[model samples]
Target: MKNNLTKMMALDIYVSNLEEEKYSEITTELQPSSKKSVNLISWGIQDLFFEKELFNDLDTIKTFSKNFNWKDNVSTVIKENYYESLVLTDAEKKIIWVSNGFTKMTGYEKEFALNKTPRFLQGKETKETTKKRIQKKLQLGKPFKDVIINYRKDQSTYKCELHIIPLHNSSNSKITHFLALEKEAV
Candidate 1:
């Protein structure tokens, strides 16, 4: 048990160091220190493989895990020479992945929203046509992109033009995942 805890702590430290290094070389408009600290604790808790009690006691761990894609967003920003973006999941619909230029546009850190569903971006005024389009594509294992009104957590709406591609896992025709991208409309 002690050895396991030690290993968990070691791995957590390694991941935290990597994150710190990455943040240091990247964005300067904000400090990711708070997010990093939460992530470090989350990693340690997960490594320990404790019970639900411990897990929920540090609900931030779950929050951090869900937002794990911020790392990807940061890397993408660097690679594409953009500012920021968001990645989402359709966990209820079957693990669909989606992303938006959030950091580049909105100020929310990816760590604060790792496992969030893109529906969080939806608004009361958002057209059903757009939802239908997404459903059609999701059903047919096809990819599609369109412009629509999307809301942020702050109740502010913005026009988002986005696209998605279905990823198949097998030559036998098994769909494994969907990768979606959202870009702010001009």
Candidate 2:
């Protein structure tokens, strides 16, 4: 279902972040109403939400096209592959969902993570300016990605290649979800 929507939205990278307020701001600014039809925004948000969730589970992400209810909406040629990473969200953001990959990277299982903020991953080394930029963009409901430092359970720091995207219901053009992606480097 989500894969179909991604093709429709032509999304290169799909992500949801824990920081809903910040991601919301970016969406409103970058995706202008004059540029995109309401229908397009609705479809994109719905599809991206499903895709991010499916991507979290190894099985779901692998069998997405086959198991999803929206088989009719997706293309047959789409590929299924999961990227191992950590997914984090704020207590407020958990109402939406989190991905399985999140546990793999952060060593924190979903059961222990739900209702917690991903800011736990941020430490003294995390860049303040980059953090502010991400927060500001998400506050506006926009998509964002950048490299910044984040802490892990071991208190070890690594570069986080982060991606955050906003999901809108579009009935009122409201951003209901913020998707986040975090991969380690450096």
Candidate 3:
């Protein structure tokens, strides 16, 4: 029927917009008929999407841990927190890898953040004292947690909590990288 065809078309459009991350445009353009279908699709798809993302994150963590010979430590950390984003930086504080969730949270794609320092996320509103504290913690070479204001690519500010752990090379027992489990403060 024409009604069925229209609903299917609307669902397709809605899905396309979701894939494009056009969240702001989705609500304004929604129709009553399409809304119901979208709701149903969202319920079904959201779980699968979450599972896939979780698996991907786990795999990334596994790979990094294996490379760094810190599987046991990383596994314990993973069990303790559900992170929204993961960032890996060299000992020098240059970003090396970021999870897809990092882009979702910060609006900065991995490519844009690669080879840059996490300091790029800081802005005028970010506290200098917080920066100093983070520096001190990093120098201590210990795992620590802190919250700070971070700016998105669009320049919007958000409270970000970082659980930072130092990655030490097993052979040399020297710090090689820092892994940050990041989440947006609710």
RMSD of each: 16.4, 13.0, 14.2
- State TM-scores per candidate: 0.46, 0.53, 0.70
Poorest lDDT segment (10 consecutive residues) of candidate 2:
70-79
TM-score of 2: 0.53
What are the lDDT figures for the candidates, one per model?
Answer: 0.49, 0.54, 0.80
Error of 3 at 45 (Å): 10
Query: Which of 2 and 3 is ahead in TM-score?
Result: 3
Which tens-of-lDDT digit does each residue in 1-186 have in candidate 1? Answer: 567655654543334334457757654633445643322557666445333323332343234334543222222322332112334344245323223345434455555555665665677989999788777757876544556688766677777755554544334445444545565554
> Model 3, range 17-51, lDDT digits (tens) per residue?
25345765575665565445332557667667656
Between candidates 1 and 2, the one scoring higher on TM-score is: 2
Task: Give the poorly placed runs of model 1, Cα more than 4 Å off.
Answer: 1-100
lDDT of 2: 0.54
What value does the lDDT take at residue 154 in candidate 1? 68
Give stretches of model 3 more than 4 Å off: 1-51
Q: What C-alpha lDDT, on a 0 to 100 scale, does residue 37 get in candidate 1?
A: 32
Worst 10 residues of 1 by lDDT: 69-78
Ranked by TM-score, top first: 3, 2, 1
Q: For residue 124, what is the lDDT in candidate 3?
A: 100
